[model samples]
Target chain A: MEYAYYPGCSLEYSGKPYDKSIREVFKALGVKLRDIKDWNCCGATMYVSIDKIVACSVAARNLALAQNMGCDICAPCNSCYTILRKVNRYLAYDPEMRGKILEVLKAANLTYDTPVDVRHPLDILVNDVGLDTIKEAAPYRFDGLKVAPYYGCQLVRPEHHFDDVDDPMTMDNLLTALGADVVPFASKVRCCGGSLMTTCEEVALDLNNSILKDAEDNGAEIMVTACALCQMNLEGYQKKINKRYSQKHNMPIVFFSQLIGLALGVNPKRLGLQSMLVKPKNLKLIPKGMKVEA
Target chain B: MPSIPPIPEPKRQREADLREAFLKEVAGIPAGEKIKNCIQCGTCTATCPVSRWMDITPRETVALFRAGMLEEILESRTIWICASCYSCTVRCPMGIQVTDLLYALKRLATDKKIYPSRFPAHALSDTFISSLYRFGRIYELELGLRYFLKTHPLKLLANIGFGLLMIIKGRMAILPKRIKKANEVKAIINRAKELEGV
Candidate 1:
C-alpha cells in the first residue's frame, strides 16, 4: 500500500528516531510512504488553542498537498495525526469552519477537494497491515523483552476510531505478536503533559513522574510509545523526575517503530537506537553481539 | 508559573458581552454547547491529571460559564493547566466537549489579552507560531531557547549542557530546514487571520 507520509516538525527534529524507524519499518513491510512535498506544520495543539480558523487553514495546506499525491496521508506524530483528523472532522461537520478554510486556501491559490484519511503507523501496522503479515515479515523477536505500551493521549482518546481509549491493545497485541512480554500498565493511555515540560516544569514533572513510576512498578524494562511528545517528555525529563520525586526511573523510552525495526532485524543505527538519552539496558539482540544498549 | 489572580465575582452588566462572545464561539465547537448538560459531576476534574494545579475545576469552569461568569473562568489557571489530554472529553457522561471548550476559552482569553500576567504557556504558543510562520516548521532547539528566554531564562542557562548533548546526538538540528513554500504557507496563514478577523 502507498501513503503520502507527512512527518510533522517534531519527527523532523527531536523525534528523528520515530521518523527514521517508521520509514525503515514500513519499507521492510514492502509498504510505500511518499513524503508530502513542502509540507508545513499541522499547527499542532498550540495553533488550535490560539486560532482555530488559522490552524485549520494551515493544516488544510498539508491536506491539499497530500491530495496531490492522490492517496491517504499517514502522520506519525500523535498531535499531527489528531490535528489533521480534527480539521477533516470540522470540514465535514462545521460549514463555517469549512467556508473559512476554503476562503483562506483560495487566497493561497490552492484547493482541497477530497479530504484525505490520516492514519497512524500503529493503525496501519496492526490493523491494515495485520499481525499475520508482520509475523511473516518480522524475522526477529523481542524474546520475552518486557515492554510497556505508552499510547500517550492523542492517539486513542477524544476519538475512538481505531483503538479503545482507556484500554488500547493495538500496541500490546502488536508487541506480543513480536514476542515481547507486554506488561500491564494502568497509565498506558495517560498524558505526558507535552510542552508543559518546558512551560510548567513542576506540574509537567508530576505528570511524567506518575507515568514513569507506573511503568517501572509494572516491571517494564522499557517503555514504547507512538507519540513524539510522549517519547520526548518521558525520556528527556526522566532525570528531572527522578531528582524531584526521588524515584529511580531509568527505563528507556523508544518509539514503537524502533522496537519493531529491531524485531524485524533492521540495523539498530537505522532505527536511531543510539540517540536515546537513557540506554535500553534490558534489550537483547536476536543475532547476538549487535546490541547497542548496555 | 504566573500567579493567577483571585477569581472575579460576577459583575453582571459589565461582562455580558464577554459571556455572549464566549458562548457564541463555544457553540461552534462540536457538542461544545452540551456543556449546558454538565451536571457538575466533577468527572472532568477527576479525570484531569493536573487538576490540582488548576484554580477552578473543569466542572466548576463549566458551571461558571453556564452561569455567565466568563471573567472568573478566564481569570483562573484552569484553562492553561489543561494539557488537552481529552481524558475528560471522552469520559464526560453528558458527551460534553470539555477539552474543546477549554481550547476555545484559551483563544478567547488570548484575543482579549486578559490571561494571567507572564503566563509561560502563552510564550510557548507564541514561539511555536512565530517559528511556523518564519520557516514553515518548528525548529526545536530555537523553539526551546526562545521559550526559556521569554519565560524562564535561568532554566535555559541550566540546560545548556543538555542542549549541547541533544545537538551532538543528532536528535536536534543546529539550523532549521526551511520548507520551499514558506512564503506560500505564510500567505495562507495571513489570509486566514484576515478572514477570521472580519
Candidate 2:
C-alpha cells in the first residue's frame, strides 16, 4: 500500500526515533510512504490557541499539498493528526470558514478539494495493515514484556472516528498480537499536557507524574505510545518530575513503531533506540548475539 | 457596640450592563454561544489536571461568562494557566466546548493586554507563533533560547545542563530544518492574518 507521510516538526527533532522506526517498520511491511513534498508545520495546539483561522489555514496548506500526491496522508504525530483532522472537519462543515481559508490558500496557489483521508500511523497499522499480517511478519516475540500502551488525548478525543475515545483498544490489541503483555493501563487516554511542558511546567509535570505513576503501579516495565509529544513529555521530563516529586520511577517510554520494529527483527540502531533518555532495560529480552541479517 | 452604617450594595444596573457586554462578546466568537448551555456541572473542573492552580474553576469561568462578568474572567489567571489538554472538552456532559472557550478567553486577554507580564506560558505562545511565521516550521533550539531570554534568563542558565544533554544525545539540532518555498508559507500566513483583520 502507498501513502503520503507527513512526519510533522516534532518527528524531525525530539521525535526522531519515532520518525526513524516508523519508516523502517513500514518498509519492512512493504508499505510505501512518500513524504509530502514541501510540508510545513501543522500549527499545533499552541498556534490554534493564538489564532484559529491562521492555524487552520496553515494545516489546510499541507492537506492541499497531499491532495496533489493523490494518496491518503499518514501523520505520525498526534498533534498533526488532530489538527489536520480538525481543519478538514471544520472546512467540510463550515462553508464560511472554508471560503475564508480558500481565499488565503488561493494566495499560495493551492486548493484543498477534500481529496484524501488524514490518518495517524497507528490507525493505518492496526486497521489497514491488519494484526494477522503484523503477527505473521514478526521474526521475534516480546516474550511477555509488560507494556503500558499510552494513546494520549489527541488521538481519540474531540472526535471519535477511529477508535473508542475513552476505552481505546487498538494499540493494546496490536501489541498483544505481537506477543507482549498489555497492561490494563487506566490512564491510556489521559492528556500528557503536550506543549504545556514548556509553557506551564508545574501542571505538565504533575499530569505526567500521574501517568508514569499509574504505569508503574500497574507493573509495566515500559510504556509505548503513538504520539511524538506524548513520548517527549512522558520520557523527556521524567528527570524533572522525579526531582520535583521525589519519586523513583525509571520507566522507559518508547514509540509503538520501535517495538514493532524490534519484533520484526529490524536493527536496533535503525530504530534509534539508543537516543531515548530512559533506555529500555529489557534489551535482555532479545536473545544474545541474535541480529537481523543484513 | 456602636451601630455601623450598612455597606452600600453593588448597583443592579451596573451588573446588568456587565452581563450584557459579556454576552455580546461571547456571541462574537465562533461556537462560543454554546457556553450558555453549561449547567454549572463541575465535570470540566474535575477533569482538568491543573484546576487546582486555576484562580477560577472551569465551571466557574463559564458561569462568570454567562453572568456577563467579562472583566473578571478576562483579568483572571485561569485563562493563562489552562494547559489546553481538552480533557474537560471531551468529558463535558453538556458538550460546552470548554477548551475552546478558554482559547477565546486567552485571545481576549491578549487583546486587552491584561495577562501577567513575564508569564512564561503566555510568552511561549507568542514565541511559538513568531517562530512559525518566520521559518514556516518551529526551530526548537531557537524557540527555547528566545523563550528563556524573554521569560527567565537565570532559569535558562540553570537549564543549560539539560539542554546540553539534549544536544549531545542528538535529540535537538543546532540548526532548523527550513521548508523549501518558504515564501508560499509567508503568503498564506499574511493572507490569513489580513482575513482575520489582525
Candidate 3:
C-alpha cells in the first residue's frame, strides 16, 4: 500500500523518533510513504483556539495538496490527525464555513476538490495493512515484553469514527500481534494534558503522574503510545513529575512505531531509539544485529 | 436580643442585556450555538483532567454562559487553562461539544483582550501563530525564544540545560524548514483574515 505522509512540526522536532520509526516500519512492511511536499503546520489546538477560521483555512490547504496527489494522507501526530480530520468534516458539513475557506483557498490558487481521508498511522497499520501482514513481516517477536498501549485523547475522542472512544482496541491488538504483552491499562484513553505543561505545570504534571502510576501499577515495563505529545509529556517530564509527586516512576515511553520496527527486525538506530529520554531497559531482549533463524 | 428589621430590596435591577449580547456573539461563531443545548449535567467537569485547577469547571463555564455572566467567566482563568483534550466533549451526556465551546470562549477572550497579560499560554499561542505566518511553518528556535522573552525570561535561563541537551541529541533544529511558496501561505492567511473580518 502507498500513502501520502504528512509529518507535522512535532515529528521534525521533538518527535523525530516517531517519524523515523514510521518510515522504517513501512519500508519493512513493503509499503510506500510519499512525503507531502512543502507541508506547513496543521494549526494544532493552539491556532484553532486563537483563530478558528484561519486554522481551518490552513488545514484545508494541506487537504488540497493531498487531493492533488490522489492518495489519502496519513498523519502520525494525534494533534495533526485530529485537526486535519476536523477541517475536512467542517468543510463538508458547514456551508458557511466552507464558503469562507474556499474563498481563502481561491486566493492562494488552491482548491480542495473532494474530502481526503485523514488517517493516523495506527489506523493504516491495522486497517489498511492487516495485522497478519504485520505479523508476517516481523522476523522476530518481542519475547513477551510487557507494554501499556496508550491511545491518549485525540486519536479516539470527539469523533471516534475509526475506534471506540471509551475503549479503543487497535493499539492493544497491534501490540499483541507483535508478541508483546499488552496490559489492560485503564488510563489508555485518558488525556495527557498536552500544551498545558507549558502553561500550567502543576496540573499537567499531576495528570501525567496519574498516567505513569497506572501504567507502572499494571506491570508495564514500557509504555507505548501512538501520539507524539503523549510520549513527550509522559517521558520528557518524568523527572519533574517525580520531584513533584515524590515518587520514582522511571518507565520508558516509546512510540508504537518504534516497537513495531524493533519487532520487524529493523535497525534500532534507524528507528531513533537512542534519542528517547528514558531508555527502555528491556531493549536488551533484541540483541544487536540479531537476525531471525529462518 | 431584639430581632433586626427586614432589609428593603434595592431599587435598580441588573438588566439581562449581558446574557443577550453573549448569546448573540456566540451565535455568530461555528458550533457556538450548541452551548444553548447544555443540560447542566456535571459530566464534563467530572471527566475533565484539570478541572480542579480551573476556577470554573467546564460544566459551570457552560452554566455561566447560559446565565449571561460573560464578564465573570472572562475574568476567570478557566478558558485559558483548558488543554483542549476533548475528554469532556466525548463524555458530555448532552453531546454539547464542551471543548469547542471552550475554544469559542478563548477566541472571545482574545478578541476582547480580556486574558491576563502575563499568561504563558497566550504568549505561546501568539508566538506559534506569528512564526507560522512569517515562515509558513513553525520555527521551534524562534518560538522558544519569543515565548520565553515575552512570558518568562528567567525561565529560559533555567531551561538552557534541557535545551542544550535536546540540541545535542539532534532533537531541535536551529533553522526552520520553509515551504516552497511561502508567499502563497501568507496570501492565504491574509485572505482568511479579511474573510473573517478580523
Find the candidate with the highest TM-score and give its number: 1
| Span of ten consecutive residues with least summed lDDT in model 1 chain B | B6-15
TM-scores of the candidates are 0.95, 0.92, 0.93
What i-RMS does every model get? 0.9, 1.9, 1.6
List DockQ for all candidates: 0.73, 0.58, 0.63
Select the stronger candidate by DockQ from 2 and 3.
Answer: 3
Worst 10 residues of 3 chain B by lDDT: B6-15
- For candidate 1, the docking band is medium
lDDT of 1 by residue, B1-198 (tens): 999985365566547868777877786787777877888999999999989998899988987876677888887878888998999999999999989999999998888766875565777898999999999999888998898888888999988988898888888899888999899899998998898773
- What is the per-residue lDDT of model 3 for residues A1-294, given as tens digits with 9 covering 90 to 100? 889999999999889999999999999998899999888888888888777789899888889888978788999999999999989887876787788898899988999878899999999999999899998877777756889999999999778778999899999999888767888799998888898877767888999999999999999999999988899899988888888789999999999999889888888899999999888887644443465342
For every candidate, the chain B TM-score is 0.90, 0.82, 0.84
> Residue-wise lDDT of candidate 3 within B1-198, one digit each (tens)?
999974333311221444554555466455667777788879888988888888888888877765556766877888888888788887876667788877777776676666754555666788889988888888877777888888878877866787777788778888888888888788998999998788
Give the true-structure RMSD of model 3: 3.9
Candidate 2: residue A135 Cα off by (Å): 0.4
Runs with alpha carbons beyond 4 Å of true place in candidate 2: A284-294, B1-32
Tens-digit lDDT string for candidate 1 (A1-294): 989999999888789999999999999999999999889998898998888889899999999888879788899999999999999998998888888899899877899888899999899988889999997877777766899999999999789989998999999999998878898899999899987887788999998999888888888999999998999899988777888888888889999999889888899999999898999886875643334343
